[model samples]
Target chain A: MNRDAPCQDEWSILVVEDHPATRQFMKLRLRKAGYRVMAAGDGREALEILKHHFCPLVITDWMMPEMDGLDLCRAIRQESWEGYVYIILITAKDSQEDIVRGLEAGADDYLSKPVHPAELLARLQTGRRILELERTLKERNQEIARLSITDPLTGIYNRRYLNDTLTVEVRRALRYKRPLGLLLCDLDHFKRINDTYGHNVGDLVLKEFAGWLQGSIRGGIDWLARYGGEEFVLVLPETDLAGSFDLAERLRRLVAEKVIATPAGDITITASFGIASFTPGGPENHPAPETLLNEADQFMYQAKKSGRNRVVGPTGNQ
Target chain B: MDIENTARNLGIGRDELLEVLEIFLEASVADLEALTEAVAAEDRSRAGAAAHSLKGAALNLGLTEVADLARTLEMAAKDGVLLGAEGQLKDLREKLQDLTQAIQA
Candidate 1:
C-alpha cells in the first residue's frame, strides 16, 4: 500500500519543447505539483539528458527544430533501458488521424496543445501509475527467480541449482585446464537421530550443519548445496584431489566435535565424507558429471563400510 | 490582457503566469523577427515554422488575440500563400506591443 501512494516528490519529469514559453510554464507547474523537473529545448537535447540521467516520465511537443516528439518516442522505444519510459506527446493538430499516427510512433499518450495546467498534471499522474506498476512487476519477477534456486529449510542452494551450476563449473575447469574438486558428505546415522529426537530436531541439526559447512568454505571459490535429505555437496574450484581430501578430513572432525543445541537438547553428530577431483590431463580423461558423482558416492560408501565419521578419498582412507 | 482571468483559466497563479509571460514576450519577439524575414524572402516553410512557434506559446498563455492572428499567418504560409502576410505581421507586432505595455503598467 505504501508503494501505491503518489510519491510525486521523488520523480523527475523531462519536458521537451522548442518553445521557451511553453517549456517554462510546464516546468513551473510540474515543480509546483511536487515533481522535480528537467527541461530540454528539443528531442535531441532530451536524448542527451536521458543518456546521463534517468527520467521515467517525458512530455514533449510535436513540432521542434532538432527532433520532434514522435521521433523521440520511436528513438526511446528502440533502445534497451533498465526501466520503462512513459512518454506523452503534445500536439496542436487535434485530428483523430494525427492522434493515431502519434500512437503508432510509440507515444503512450497524447495531449492537445495549449496545455492546461490541470490536464497536464492529470496525464502525468497516469504515467506515474503505469511506471510504478512496471517497477513492481520487475521486482516480483526477480524475487521469483531467486526463490526457485534456494533451499527452503537450510537457505542454501538446492539440488536443482547444483545440477544447473555444477555442469558449468566443470566445463569451465576443463576448458581452462584447471582442477575441480567435489566432496559429498552424509551425516552418520541421520535416520536414527530423526527417529530418536523427532523430525523437528533432525531438521534443526541439518540447518545448523549446512550453515557451518557454508561458512567454512572459500567465499566465492567454493559453494555448498543441499544434495538431498541429510546429504550435501561442496564444489571447490581450482582444488586438486589432495586439497579436497585435506578439507574433507577437517570437516569430518569438525562435524564430530560440534554440539548443535536445539530446542530439544544438545546433540552431537558425526558425518562421513568422500572426495573426488578432476585434473584436466587431456580430452580422453574428461569425465561426465555423473561419473564424478558416482565416483564420490562409491568412496563415501567405502568410508561408511570401514567406519563412520571418517573421510575416504581417491587414494585411500584418511 | 486580464492577467487574473487568464491565470485562473489556465489553472495557475498570477505570479507564475506572469513569469511565463515574460519569457513568452522575449521569445515571441525573436519569432516575429524571423517571420518578418521569411515573409520578405517568400520562404513559406520558414514563415510557417515561426508562426507555428508563436501560436503555440501565445495559446498557452491565454492570449487569444495573438494566438488567433498567429494561426492565420501560419495557415497561410503553410498553403504557400504569402499574400496579405505583411498586414498580419503588422497586426501581430501591435498586439505584442500592447501586451508589453500592459505588463509594464
Candidate 2:
C-alpha cells in the first residue's frame, strides 16, 4: 500500500483464449515476462471479470464460443468506465481485411497466432507505456481540480468553493429542515500589521491563522474557507444558534491566546467573529444564502465597532 | 514437431510445453469429432467453421502440419469445393493421432 509505488494490479493483463491450452500457455509466457496475468476461457467470462476487476490490458483470441474478441472489444468500448482499456486481438486471420475488421471493432492492436512470445512482450510494453501515460494524465487532472478549489496563499478552500458549497449546504438544510450555522471571522487591525511589519509577515500570519482555524474545526462536521483577504468563513452542519455561539467564543479565545513568531519578533493578534444560524421553519421560511451571509457580515461589523476581538449574533456579547 | 524449440521461443519450460500438448490433445478429440460430423452431414459452412477453430488451436500450439491441413480443408469448404474434402479430413485425422501419440510418449 505504498503511495509512491505503482502496484502490480495496475499493470495486470487479462488473457482470453477459448482454447484452454493456449490460454494456459499465454498466461505462463506473460507471467514469465513479469506481468501479472489472469486468464478467461472465452470473451464472455472475460467480460464478467472486466466488470469487477481493473485490468487495462486484454489479450484475446478472435474466435471463441459464446463471445469473441471483437465482440468483447465492442462491449468494452460501450462501457462507461473511468479508465481506458487497451485490447489486442490474437488470431490466425492475418489478412489485411481481417486486420482492418479488428481495428474497426475497437481493438487497439492485433497479434497473429502462433504468437511470438518476444513480439507479444514487446507489444505489451507499448501498452504499458500508453497506460502509464494515461495514469499520469489522470493524476495530473485530479491535482489540477484540487488546486483550482484551494487558496494559494492560505492553503485553504478558496472563496469560489465557499460560495458554491454554501448554496448547496443551504438547499440541503432547507430541504431537510435542519439547523445550519455560519461564522464570518476577520483578523483585527490586519492592514496596520501589513503596513508596519511587511507583506511577507502579513502573509505568514495569514497562513498561520488559517492553519490554526483548520486545526480547531471538526474534521467532518465543520469546514473552513478563506473567504477573502483577512476574512474567513466557517460552516457548521447540524448546529443550532447556541452551538454556533459556543464555537465562536472558543475560536475567538484560541486565536487571542496564540502568539505567532513573525520575522520581526513574536507578535500577538486577535480576530472578530460574527455567528449566525438558520433554523428551517418551512418552505416559506427558507432564506437565500446571501441573506444569511449578509446578516453575518453586518454582525461582524458590529463586533468590530464594539471593539475588535469579540463575537456578535443571536447569542451576542457571550 | 520441434516442440522443444517452440517452447523455448514461447519462453516456457519443457514441463509447461508438455502440459499444453496434453490439453490440446484432449480438446482436439472433441473438435475432430465435430469436424467428422459436419463432413458427414455435408454442411459446408459448419465444416468450414469447425476446421477454422481447429486450425487456430493447432497453430497456437505450434502444430504446423495439423494447422496447415485444417487450413486447406477450411479453404476448400469456403469455396464450396467439398470434393476430396473427405480425404483431406482423413489426413487431418492421422496427423492429429500422430500428435497425440507423440505428446503421450
DockQ each: 0.56, 0.52
TM-score of 1: 0.93
The regions of model 2 sitting more than 4 angstroms off are A1-10, A282-284
Top-lDDT structure, candidate number? 1
List, residue by residue over A33-97, the lDDT tens digit for candidate 1: 77889999989999999888879999989998889888999999998877999999998999999
Clashing pairs in 2: none
Best candidate, TM-score: 1
Using DockQ as the measure, which candidate wins? Answer: 1
Each candidate: chain B TM-score: 0.95, 0.90
Native contact fraction, candidates in order = 0.74, 0.72
Give residue A202's error in model 1 in angstroms: 1.3
lDDT of 1 at A219: 98
What digit string (tens of lDDT, one per residue) describes model 2 on residues A24-139?
Answer: 88887777766788989888899899888878899998988899889999998998765899999989889999999999999999999787777777788788889889999999
Please report how far candidate 2 places residue A176 from its true position, in Å: 1.2
